[model samples]
Target: MAPTRTGSKRLLHDLNQSIVFNLIMEHQAISRIKLARKSGLPASTITKIVGNLLAAGLVLEVSADESSGGRRPVLLSINASAGYVVGVRLREATITLTICDLQCNSTYTRECSYQPGTAPQQVITIMATAIRDLVAEAGLTMQQIFGVGIGLSGLIDSARGLCRVSTILGWQNVELGPALERQLKIPVRVDNDVNTLSIAEHLFGQGREADNFLLVTIGRGIGMGIVLGGAIYRGSFGGAGEFGHMTVDVRPDAPLCNCGKRGCLEALASDYGIVRTALGTDPGHAIEDAIVNLIARAHAGESEIVAIFRQAGITMGIAIANLINIFEPSHILIAGEGLRAGDLFLEPMRQTIPRHTFDARDDIELLICPTSDDLWARGAASLILHEIFQSPIYEDEEALALDDLVSQASKAQKHHKK
Candidate 1:
């Protein structure tokens, strides 16, 4: 009974601490009075919890605000330099890794190219080494690092840190989280690259204030991330937003996709597909070269190149319109490396979406944006940060005792089963 009562009290305390810390981080420079109002916690509890965080160097107090007169209230904010996390993005041809501080500021970044048929073990080794070097360069020890968050191209089971399938990498059932953890001896989080990008955009980019939005990324492959009620919607099996593979043409004559399907949106409009059509070859030079050439030709007002872009844009718009009809997100953010040619894609997409969509003028808005490679890594880091902020942090022995009790109960259950 004593142990149970102690555990209950500890759980309650940890929950309150997490809530207070999250409220401060979300509303930077918030006053204690306002934090109490927002968190529905007593002012005394908020004061005590904040003091503990400040002592741990996890939060800082900036200058006070004098808007309400009297003594200016001190404003609390997260300490951006409290710790660091590493973000790694594993793409088909390149692996990008970034070291970011608590505020999601990149302190260092490294890029490495992988051979076309690189094995998963080889790739993981290189990734681990890159992460180690980045942390060493930052003069931080392993313990100072929070964890590593990886964004990989595939159907990622983010909850388990597993890659369900990646046609590009020829990978399936890859235990990415456990593998990284084993090599690095640190906590790890993994998610689909596009989903991670959506999280990044929602937190820091175009979707920041949007309660509901759709982020469509066009590049090596097309994918989307849906944010509903200000949160990412990962459906059952963590495959909700694979919009790229959604069927657009059911005709048997349609082009085959890398996924062994015909008439998929990715089969027609992905970077590889576009380049294959433009160059008139199945196996040709790098798609990047073709894109550069296309951009130059479009800039030179070459009608053929412009027409191809226009057609692709219209197809993309039609796909988006379909998404709108179903989900009806408030804002649709078009991003990815391919957005460099947004000027060529925008007009056709704008023209076609309206033709296909049935909506009032103010229902949804579309915005085209470009993102840097670092943004992908930052998105990965945001994944870890979300988990950390939501996790209960115990500041006293009572919480530790409660955790021990829970562990013991689990062990006893296992023993009984045997």
Candidate 2:
């Protein structure tokens, strides 16, 4: 018993030590000098930390780069195979799951279809099973997994792990984090899918260097994620970027929105809106056929279709301009499936945005980019990695350890009572 207790204590201590060392491996590639500078710990403390990290195989010395005044200094980086995380994205009709290592390299990815009318519990079970299978296929044990992050389309209260509403999935008041944590026995983070995707782009994609930008996604629905001051703005109630719901048409006779509002931007400019307008002209028209017809009409200079797209573009531009007038982001990224008609929409949006923007800030950059379906799932995984690295663990090791100890004790007490 004494030996067992000693071993347990050593294991816990080593685990806590590894957490800090892993953070350095992920964030920086430098010698002890820069490591101490970045981590704000003394040289001796950094030496001890790196020594333990090296012994545990969590970090590796890549190469030595020479300083101007002295010999080359060895740089440290995360051992990519040290551990892995699972990211799951649940959409209206599909589920995407991915497994990634400490360095954010994806090991495997899988996609499964969900019934349109599936319940939240059913979706949760499917997601959990998919994650377990993917981790097992990767030959990793449960202890090797860092955590799980889930991204869903909806009004998500990320801080509280509650999804207040998911219009796409027809869900509301779902306790997503607690449910997943209970099943997976790992830390779980649930966030708005667009916000997650924006973070992923900010860290790993085109927005990596941009401190301020707006990520607008137009698809079955429309949404935007505001990145201000290098952090996602979740608003007062965690529903900050509902740009889609902004009213674009004040006419009472305009189309009704999914949220039961009339003439919303989503009802005017989304893919569904475009298709609906096209089909209204010819009742037997398929959506794809309508897209082709609309494109042809725009190309042939048909006034009606052109006017419809132009009106939608103007509304979209107004919304974007309003956001810019308030936040002054350096760039706005337009992405999603709806961008298939980029040529038709870009001109009108570009024209209208400048017209409405204050101070002639039409100089703000606007970029139209294409995104794949898996991007959101990858973003979810990035969220877990971000939290793991940027949390208080890297700053005050003792405080992090104490917090973990208290959490573990509380869980144990609840289990004993059960």
Candidate 3:
């Protein structure tokens, strides 16, 4: 009973601190008074939380600037150099590793490949080795790594850090988070790759302002990440973002999807499907001139090549129109490697979306951003960063551990300096 009470007290304190911390992060150079006002916490509570953050070396006090008051207030900002984080993205055979600072600026990246059907344990071992090598290459100790965040395709149970199923990886119920944690000796978080990208966008991209939006990624897969009411909406069983699996084409002769389902949107609009069709290649055969070449042909006005992209764009547009009608999101962000086709691929989607949507509003904005492996890897890193700065009300045991890592990292930095 005593221990339980103590734990509860600690949690409340941590929650309060998190509230204050987030206020400081968002405001960047906010005064204690401004923090109190923004966080709705009492002035004394704000003072205590700020003091703790300063003492922890997680935040810094900047000199006061001009203010229309008797005494100007000092500003607070996060210590970007307080620690480091590792972000990893796992494709079917290739793994990308990224090391970023607390601010999520990627400083180092590594690419590694494995046999396509590598066992889960073998894949985890590959990740552990690459991370260790990259950390050493970056001239940082393991202690400096706050944690590792991993993003992979398919049905990821983020809360449990389990890969419920990844058609791309040929895995099922793999305890990826725990398996990586054992080797890395730090906290680990796993999420759907698209969801991770959405997290990064929410924190730093177009999603900073838009609360209700959908992130539709198209590449090896066509998936969507949903954000509603300023929160990521992972539906029951944590499979909410499987937008690519939607039955867009129901015909028996429609292309087969990797999910063992026929006529999935992924089958018709995904990179493999479109490229396979354009090149007249059998499934699983690498086309001589791949998607890039096909895109070039489309750009050159090759009628047949252009037709394939137009059809794919129409299919994707219809799917998005369905998304718009159902969710009525204020913004739709389209990203992923498929954008390489340029207007040849997207112009049709842009043109087709409005036609299918019911009462589509002029105010809804569509955002398209370039994608890269580095960006995706950074998105993975933001998974750890998200937990660190996440609102305490929504936090669970993981938040407590993340906070502990922050304190530990700060102390490690100070010890190294000493």
Candidate 4:
């Protein structure tokens, strides 16, 4: 259906407002004239949009230097305190939650855990309780929250806010959005955890300056988030970032992957894969101390362990090289718990990448990002911000409606108090 003229005008206005808002965010304390020039919007449009932003308390006028001659232009900055958003990162047994203000600053965070094999309903209940409790702990009301975003490892149908499948959680066809909204009376978004990390990098992290990049996470599992043409490419079924499962080994004796495959990249190169190789190769290593002890062993010059780590790095490098050749992204961001091994592991991968990559390899920027459960949770929260701040022409209608609901709830709360 074609959009009416009124709808088209509204959308154009929203797009311009987003442009102005993004400019102000990029260059803090920017003048209205600068905004008009940068956004390519007319001066009058900038004034109207900035006036609306100021009236809504979303942006504030900062003190301008009076010594800059007659009538110094007023500079504007985003109101970081305008509202808060909640982010949740769900792991196999633990859920991390955090609250961030408008500027994506973490004001409060907490974690809760459940036993493995817990029912999905029980997990949802626990997550909702944690969110409500944490918000109260932070002295915030539901009205103050813009929305909640949940990220977990799985095949997620983000449009429907449903988990299509999650081997980590043993979940299938779970509706995260409706479930949480019913409990909390607010908006909710759910996505693949790696996708959330990619969104974070695109919006606020290293990928901000680059339009195309790959966010690869190496840990218990290896994952990749592909961004091209300035937007995430979710493939046909939203299962696109399963770079871990890509076949990197083809030998008949290759290690078995948890996905019932042999010679998969994750089977040979993930931290868990390295641990598996270590435990099976040596009889002296009987007890499991997780990846930490394995890293320590490598640091202490355990030749066998070091070799295993290097092999993992080389395998990952080969796969990453293929990724660079295929996608031709300008940057690659490596982040995950697996980084605890430090240079002993990553250096080989970095060196091997160029060896296998095609031409223009030097043009690609490689970045190593520090990762934690907190960062993952914060990345999930940034998904909501991404939905709000993205260019309106490409904005999701459902997300726009949710933002409207959030605003209405806040307005109602303020009016009731009045």
Alpha-carbon TM-score of each model against the true structure: 0.88, 0.82, 0.93, 0.92
| C-alpha RMSD for every candidate | 7.4, 7.8, 3.1, 3.2
lDDT of 1 by residue, 159-199 (tens): 77899999888899988888888999877889888888888
lDDT of each: 0.78, 0.74, 0.85, 0.83
For residues 282-388, could you state the per-residue lDDT of candidate 3 as single tens digits? 44524324877788878888999899999999999999999999999999999999988888879999999989899855578999989899899999999989888
Sum up the clashes in candidate 4.
0
Name the lDDT of candidate 3. 0.85
- Candidate 1 weakest lDDT stretch, 10 residues: 396-405
Error of 1 at 133 (Å): 0.3
lDDT of 3 at 108: 90
- Cα lDDT tens digits for candidate 4, 39-115: 78898898887877776667889988454567888789988777789999998778999999777789999999898
Best candidate, lDDT = 3
Give residue 168's lDDT in candidate 3 (0 to 100).
73
* Candidate 2 lDDT by residue in tens digits, 1-418: 0012233654554444545564565565767787777666678767876775565455778878777876888888867666567888887778888888766677888888878778888888888888888888876666667678788888998877899998778899999888988899888888998898888877777787789999999876799998987778888889989988888789978887778788888887876677676556422224445666687888898888887777777778888888889889899998887777766876788888877789869568888878766667778887777664543322322122423422343443344346
Residue pairs clashing in model 4 are none
Residue pairs in collision within model 1: none
Candidate 3 clashes: the total is: 0
> Which 10 successive residues of model 4 have the least lDDT summed?
281-290
